[model samples]
Target: MTATGLTPSTQGAPDPASQAAARPTAHHPARAPGRLARSVRRNLTAHGFLIGAVVCFALFSWYPMVREFLLAFQKTERGRTTWVGLDNLTTVVNDPAFWQAWRNTLLFTALALVLGFAVPFVTALVINEFRHGQGYLRLLVYLPVMLPPVASVLLFKYLYDPGYGLLNELLRLLHLPEQQWLQDPDLAMLSVVVAATWMNMGGATLIYLAALQGIPGELYEAAELDGAGLLRKIWHVTIPQTRLILTLMLLMQVIATMQVFVEPFLLTGGAGPEGSTTTVVHLIYQYAFSFNNYGAAAALGLLLLVLLAGFSAAYVRLSRTEEA
Candidate 1:
């Protein structure tokens, strides 16, 4: 009925779909603000947590390191602080105990690697072979790690007592001559290493156990099919599979053993018979608290820090190269 040859009502009226599409959407402005507020609150909360962590690290860790670096160059005497440059380093180097401490520390590190490093891996391997009671075994192995460190050290001290100690009693019962465990200078460092290994190997054992569990069974089976013995399988399959973890553990063990303190400090009173157990950290303790030479302590600590940092850097670089 119109110029287009359609009904007038159809021609004049708007399409329902077009009107629906063209009309402005009914947005809930309240919802938009609510969402924005929630997002801002979340961001603020996350940032607050991040800021708290950063502040804590800055206050506790970074500030102390910076202070130590500054203290290494400055000396406090008679309530007056003066910059003494390399005097602290010279003093620490000149101390008679310095070389002795370094020697003892290196010896302890070697001993610990032989005992502490190998014992845990062997224990883990043994435990991993068990088909049952794995959880109980793990708990038993980790029990020592759960004990308070001071309590454990005291316990070892009691056990090391030459007179009527359990270890001495066992030796006597077995018709073996009872040796002075901690009294003799030759035995003192070895006794301390033993105690240290017993105290710390629990954690390492669990870590190795976890690494061993992650190795696929197929490799072991293939190794068995190749007529490999237990030792051979361990060497070829197990070691390769856990090579990364072993490398990491080796580095950690070296670092930890080099910083040996608590065991020697508790077992032999920081300086064992004839200064045999005098470690680098023990020397630092002597310098700071015993000798009241904070500058010397800081200088010694800086040397240790640099040595450890350099070793860690080298280790990381080597690991990266191996991975590549």
Candidate 2:
């Protein structure tokens, strides 16, 4: 539009058509920051706790994991870090002791799970059926868990004493040949497994007991009406109802058993009887501290981590499937 609000030809004499052709002047009020400022403040306050938590997680958990990975790929000598590619992992993989430790750990895990898992469930079922002294039985089962691992392992060490150990003495009294519990390599893992099973059964027992109580009484009543035997009722009703919990506990037990450290560390004093009781965590300790090879230790730790993650993923999938 021209100054006179008309085109050049109609400038002098205003053309009604040209004036009508001019575009409308558009107005937009400038925005105030009040609403935006309030929104920013609300977001800042709401996420303040979350931001702090994330920072702490990064500073501690994430940083340590990443550092361990870096250390796994690099070797350190006299305060100097040198990139060694997969040398650390290769050394760990090539070590002859690795296979033995793996075997021992797996054996311990299988035995522990078999004994530990079933003991609690059976105990829970029996005790749940009982009419009296339930509290005392639960207390007895949990009592060992309250004892310090060192104390408990040490106590078992006394009991496993070949010469005067109560266990051997009992066997001797029963007209049975005495067997070395902790001394013999053939029995050392078994001995530790028994002790670990005893010490750890409490937690699983408590969880299963709680789950058992949560089971609906109607199921049992219906099974009774159907003339189902005790075993059949357990197989059909109890097992299915508690299957999720049993599966979860099984996976958790696997993870915890894989990281068997304190028990063997104290019981066998770092891998028992020619490393027959050596576990993966114990080996990692020996590598990182005893041999002072942080790289190999870190590499082995990363391997253990991968194994745990795989187990956990499978557990999650199985759990979700059970839910579905």
Q: lDDT tens string, model 1, 51-169? A: 99999999999999999999999999999999999999999999999999999999999999999999999999999999999999999999998998899998988898999788999
- Give the runs in model 1 whose Cα sits over 4 Å from its true position: 1-30
Superposed by TM-score, candidate 1 places the C-alpha of residue 2 at a distance from the truth, in angstroms, of: 19
Once fitted onto the true fold, the runs of candidate 2 whose alpha carbons sit more than 4 angstroms away are 1-60, 321-324
Index of the highest-TM-score prediction: 1
lDDT of 2 by residue, 1-324 (tens): 566656355438866777777866678876669988998999998899889999999999999999999999999999999999999999999999899889988998898888978988998898898789999999998999999888898899989999989999999899999988777899988888889989888989989999998989999999999999999999999999998889889988999999999888888786788888999899999999899999999999999999899989987987788679
lDDT of 2 at 284: 94
Give the Å shift of residue 279 in candidate 1.
0.6
Reference-based TM-score, model 1: 0.91
Q: Which ten-residue region of model 2 has the weakest summed lDDT?
A: 2-11
Each candidate's number of clashing pairs is: 0, 0
Cα lDDT, all candidates? 0.94, 0.90
Q: What is the TM-score (0 to 1) of candidate 2?
A: 0.82
